[model samples]
Target: MSRRRRLRSRMLALVLVGSLAGLTAVGGPAIADTLSDKRAAAKKQEQENAAKREQLAASLEGLSAELGQALLDLQAMEQRMPQAQAELAEAQESLDRSQREATLVAARLQDALDQEVSIGSTIEQDTARATRIRESIGQMAREAYKGGGTATSMDIVLGAKSTEEFIEQYGLVSTALRTQTNTLDELRELQAQNANSQARLEAVRGRVQELKAEADEKVVEADAARAQAQERKDEIQQLISQQAAKKAQIEDQKAAAEAEAAAADAEAAKIAAELAAIAAQQRAAEAAAAAAAGKPQAPAGPVGGSLFANPTSINPMYVTSNYGMRLHPTLGYVRLHAGIDLRTYCGTPIYAGRAGSVQWAQYRNGFGNQVMVDHGLVNGSSLMSSYNHMTSFSVRSGQRVEQGTLLGYSGNTGTSAACHLHFEVYVNGGTQDPGPLLGR
Candidate 1:
């Protein structure tokens, strides 16, 4: 009976020890596990919130950069428009002057032609007068022949009945002959003068024709020059029109971007506030639980967050687009985006997202001057990052860089529609959604 009591007591002691171990496991390890799980869940939620915030920031940044570049382009075009207008005005003035000169030349040519006509009419009249004089001389010679060649002053004196009559008849015949000779001589002299005048007029007409031809040539040349100038002015105007259209489009985009950015920022702020509230609640609950259980509270801050830093010094305002399948801006087709687009202006500094060695630093097709970094590994995965559309780069292929290291300046190179950064993340050898990796 004594031996049976000892064994039962030993068994009772073992039972009590097992019961206490079970209680300790339920009260301590169970509570610790629950707290740890809660902390992990909260950290995950926080990371998701951070990722969303980052996306918003990138979008705002992209929009701002696009708007700024558009404004700059518009300003440059506006400044050049005035110069184009001035050139057009000058061209018009030149054209007008040419037309005026042409008109003057035409009038001069008409005057020259009129003068030629007048001179020709005078020559015709002079020619007719000469013909009449020749006919009259022929008639006088016929009359002299019909009256007999011997009918002279001596015959007139012989036929006279008295001395006075003889003297009068002789004087009359001599006076008639002398008057005829003088009239013929004057007709010949007038004909010769008319012929000389006609010759001079003909020479003047020839010179007038030459002058008119020269004037006509000048008019043609001036017209051609005016047309050329006008065409040039028109081309400039066309260029101005194109630029204006581009400016308008940019302005519209800017307005939209600004509105979107504002909304995104507000949303992000709201989300951040909510996350903060949740985090505070989680912290308070954890503290309360720890106090009740007589254990330490869970640590604060993000857990298993992104290792990469922002690729820019300034915090991005919003995300333009996330890496995924989307419609191409220019190609009008569904395609893989393969990267995240961040808002950035021309000349904005670009930085490495993680410490790595540069795999490539050169101009790439459709990506512009790009920098690709091989980060070796992150979270047991081979990771890589690329920065695209840079204006200039401070790093080179085979070079080493730390996180946040300046790589280059942002730009609108390659096939980009605006100035911005195309940030890409890779896992192993393939592209992946950069959102989660960025703690989005």
Candidate 2:
């Protein structure tokens, strides 16, 4: 009997020990819960850091593109400037050529006028001499005709003492009369020819004057054309100046944008460093906690929930899509998926993820009932987030909301296959991947 009691006591001790082990197994997870929580918080911070980094990168790229375009504009303006200068030079050359031709033509016209004046003087002198000679010949003819016809007949009928005397007297009378008539005729003809020559010379002089006037007019026209061309060049130069000023202004804007982007990049880096440090600290804490409890560290931080500070269930949960490339439900082909989709029962409550002011609330083509919130300006610019596809809204367009405040309800109001939330973050006006910021 004594031996049986000892064996029973030993069996009872074994049973007690087995029961204690079972209770410990059941309570082990609860004991290590704090470690899990710490790890999850760390991971959430890291995810936010990554999202910020992406935003910074996108801003940098856009700034770079703007700067490049500005440079091209400035270069085009520079090119136009040279062309305008060349055109101006050409216009000046044309003006100079016209002026020189006008000077030469004026000199030639003066010479022609001088020659015509000398020729006119000579013609006037010749005309006066011819008139005097004709008047003398007319007087001699009148005197000869004054002798009666009977006296001229008797002198011719009476023979001279000798034939020689008669012949000489007759020859003398005839020669004198013929010479006077011929002299008068030659003077008249010379007078007529001199008048004609003077007329022709005057006509030539008039033509020279006309040529001078025409050349002067042409010079004036060329000068006007040159002036017009110069004016055009000036206008082009003015345009180039304005364009250059505009380019400078745009360059200033680009510089400002680049500075802003750089600042954003720096801030993102700082945030990432803080997140990494926090994660390391949490990991250290978790390691200590696990050692103390003598169990494996719980898999902290849910797969998609490691990126936000306060992740909570404000609305009923459903996952419609996940990250990475997937065949688009509506686009009908493979496309890069930037974020995950959270579906819910139609009209279910949707809540704010953080404290912020409502920036905009409206309907969009694909997003339907969209709501954008401006948390605040970061690195010299606004940091905004948007939520889309809602059946109804709870908040006004510019209402402020704290974390977990009701924002709207889920719906298929947009280009959606079903009722779901389409969320996005923006550094400026561009879209960014929302997966990191949506972590829980």
Candidate 3:
């Protein structure tokens, strides 16, 4: 009975040991598979989150660039505002001066006209007096002729009685003839004076007409100048208004971008924290798996290469100018030509020279509608590219682009004299010849 009891106890202990071993094998595999599934799901979530983060980062970079550009533009506009105001003031001053001169001229003309009128009145009075004198002289001559003309003097002398009387008659006749002669001479002198006055009046009238004409011309010039000045003032005001509106728009965009960036940053931080936790858990699981399997981990893959490609698809007709010292066409002085000028028809499509982020894409002062790209690093040097005198742009600041990506269209904007592409390559913030890079 003791031997049978010992055998049953040993069999029950063996069965219990077998059941515990089977439970460990099945339950351990199930728990490992559950952990692995959880790890995979977490990794997948992490990858998705990483992709989202990358996208958000790109967007944030673009927004920052846009904000920077906006600030620069606003500053530039602010600077130009004073210059425009100064120009307007100068124009107004010139217009005012012209108007004052015109007013003076007009006053002078009125004075000349008044003098001419007064001279005309004096001439009319002189003419009337001369006519009256001529009529009186004619009447005297007719009366003398009706009274027997030259014989009247002799009859007067004969009508004297004695020698004394005859002497008196002769004296009387001589005296009367002398008086008539004096009167005729006086009338002739008056007529000559009237003729001289008329001639002087004609000259004065001509001078007055000339003065009036000059005054009219001055008034016309002043009116034109005033009109031009007004137009310029209006244009400047309109430009200021436009700049203000643009600044406001940029401010709004910047505010929205900042808000978005903040949200994205928070979300990315949350995702990073979750990823970190997941990574720690995964590392622990992997380490455990490795320990269980007694194997080593594989290495990661290699990184990709960074090389540039041609910017545009279309072949240019010819290079208009190469980078070097040359005389400027419009500026009329020796200056450094910092870029290669590529001649092409207006509205030609422009492309990116390399895969990079856009630094700026807007209307620059001298460059016109320009686009600048930041090629992070190439050939162990920081590189950048710029396209100037563009008519329009397709890309915005901080946007990522690939080689041959369309950036804009060629134009004759800003300081450009003709339609062309001004291509520049910058190395370490200094301009360099792009011929070698372009393989031209």
The prediction achieving the highest TM-score against the true structure is 1
TM-scores for every predicted model? 0.47, 0.40, 0.46
Once fitted onto the true fold, the runs of candidate 3 whose alpha carbons sit more than 4 angstroms away are 1-61, 64-80, 151-159, 235-248, 259-440
Residue 383 error, candidate 1, Å: 22
Tell me which residue pairs clash in candidate 3.
none
Per-residue CA lDDT of model 1 for 1-440, tens digit only, reads: 67434433433332232111111111111111376785785576457554544443333232344554554455556544544554555455555566566556655666776788888888888888888888888888898889775357668867999999888888878887887888799798988889788887988788786865666565566656556665656666576687878767865675565464455345334433443453355457667888999998655432235767778656853456887766422123455666788778789999998898997798765566888887754444456778887999999889999988999999876545466788877654456677776776
lDDT of 2 by residue, 65-170 (tens): 3453454445455544544554555455556565556556655665666778777887888888887887887777677678642234348549577778887877
Clashes of 1: 16
lDDT of 3 by residue, 1-440 (tens): 67434433433332232111111111111112376785775576457554443322212121344553454455456544544554555455566666566556656656666777887888788778878778877887898789777546568666767789888878877887887788788778877877887887888788776765666566556556656666656666676787888778775775555454455345334433443453345446555776789985332222123334555445743565677766422123454566676656688788897888897798755566878887754443456788877899999999999998999888766544456677877664566788767766
